[model samples]
Target chain A: GAGVSQSPSNKVTEKGKDVELRCDPISGHTALYWYRQSLGQGLEFLIYFQGNSAPDKSGLPSDRFSAERTGGSVSTLTIQRTQQEDSAVYLCASSPGLGPITQYFGPGTRLTVL
Target chain B: GESVGLHLPTLSVQEGDNSIINCAYSNSASDYFIWYKQESGKGPQFIIDIRSNMDKRQGQRVTVLLNKTVKHLSLQIAATQPGDSAVYFCAENLHSGGGADGLTFGKGTHLIIQP
Candidate 1:
């Protein structure tokens, strides 16, 4: 079975620029989540999407962070006006449904805001 | 705010030995817990999970124990191997009024296996 997949394994961008990270969840996964991991740090919740319903954006640190999922499948996380603090690995995961279900993750996109 | 924390930042164990990683979580309302393993350069993978209703669950060579009364969780690995060396995280899910709630992750524990 195909696992979750992410685009641009590595991205280097200048400060104040915007970057979009993509994620493709498994074929039948109805729940998708995005998280950020800084070096030597734990994973931080970013956002979650379920089917075609509105995403849970509570974890978005600021208005500069936004994410959207289309057709209940692929998702894109966009960071506006990137700062040095935004440099980290963006991870995407998908689960069969909701709570208690195990999630499968992608390789992640390492975004470096220089 | 509730917090999930690890007792140790790193644990070194010899191959074929049992490994135990401990975690303490706040928020008595939390009903589900999970453990994930992430290797360098890779995203996290689910190792096992335990629900609030149960005290323990086993999967292959891994076992997860949850103590709701104490807000504690533990993951035990049998016959540790070099392939098991990675960062392990414990996460909790609190039951909210709305849809699926977010997961709160604890500081990870780095497992190092010595052959």
Candidate 2:
């Protein structure tokens, strides 16, 4: 079975620029999540989407971070006016449903703020 | 804020030995926990999981032990191999969450295998 996939494995952008990262979840998976991993640190939860309900943005860190899942299959994480601190690896994961289920993660998109 | 944390930043184990990684979580309300392994330049891979109802669970060569009373968790790997060299993370479902209450992950322990 095909695993979750993300686009633009590497992205280098200047400060103040906006970058959008994309994620494609596995077929029929109803739960999707996004996390950020900084250098030498654990992954930080960013957002979560389940079915057609509202998305969870509790860990967005700032208003500059936002995400949207279209048709409950593909998701896009957009960061507005990027900052140096925004440089990290953005990973996407999807699961069969929720609650204790395993989340299969994508390769991740490394965002470098230059 | 309640969070999950690891006891060590790194651990070195010889081949064919058992490796144990420890974690402490502050959120006693958390009911589920998971262990994930991440190699260089890749996303985390789910290793195993355990629920609050059960104190222990085993998967293949990995075992997850959870002590809710003390708010601790541990991952034990038997017969460590070179392929086992990676960063191991412990994650918990905050507020029994999966829908919106995202998970909390520990800093991770980088396991170094010695031959």
The local distance difference test score of model 2 is: 0.91
User: What fraction of the correct interface contacts does each predicted structure contain?
Assistant: 0.56, 0.63
In model 2, the clashing pairs are none
lDDT per residue, candidate 2, B1-115, as tens digits? 5389999999999999999999999988787899999999999999999988999999999999999999999999999999999999999985445346567889999999999
After superposition, candidate 1 runs with Cα above 4 Å error: B97-100
Two-chain DockQ for model 1: 0.63
lDDT of all predictions: 0.90, 0.91
Which 10-residue span in candidate 1 chain B carries the lowest summed lDDT?
A: B94-103
Assess the local accuracy of residue B75 in candidate 2 as a C-alpha lDDT between 0 and 100. 99
Q: Report the number of the highest-lDDT candidate.
A: 2
Query: Which residue pairs show collisions in model 1?
Result: none
The count of backbone overlaps in candidate 1 is 0
Instruction: Tell me model 1's lDDT, rounded to 2 decimals.
Output: 0.90
Can you write out model 1's per-residue Cα lDDT over A10-111, one digit (the tens) per residue?
A: 999999999999999999889898989999988898888888564467788899998888999999999999999999999999988877677788999999
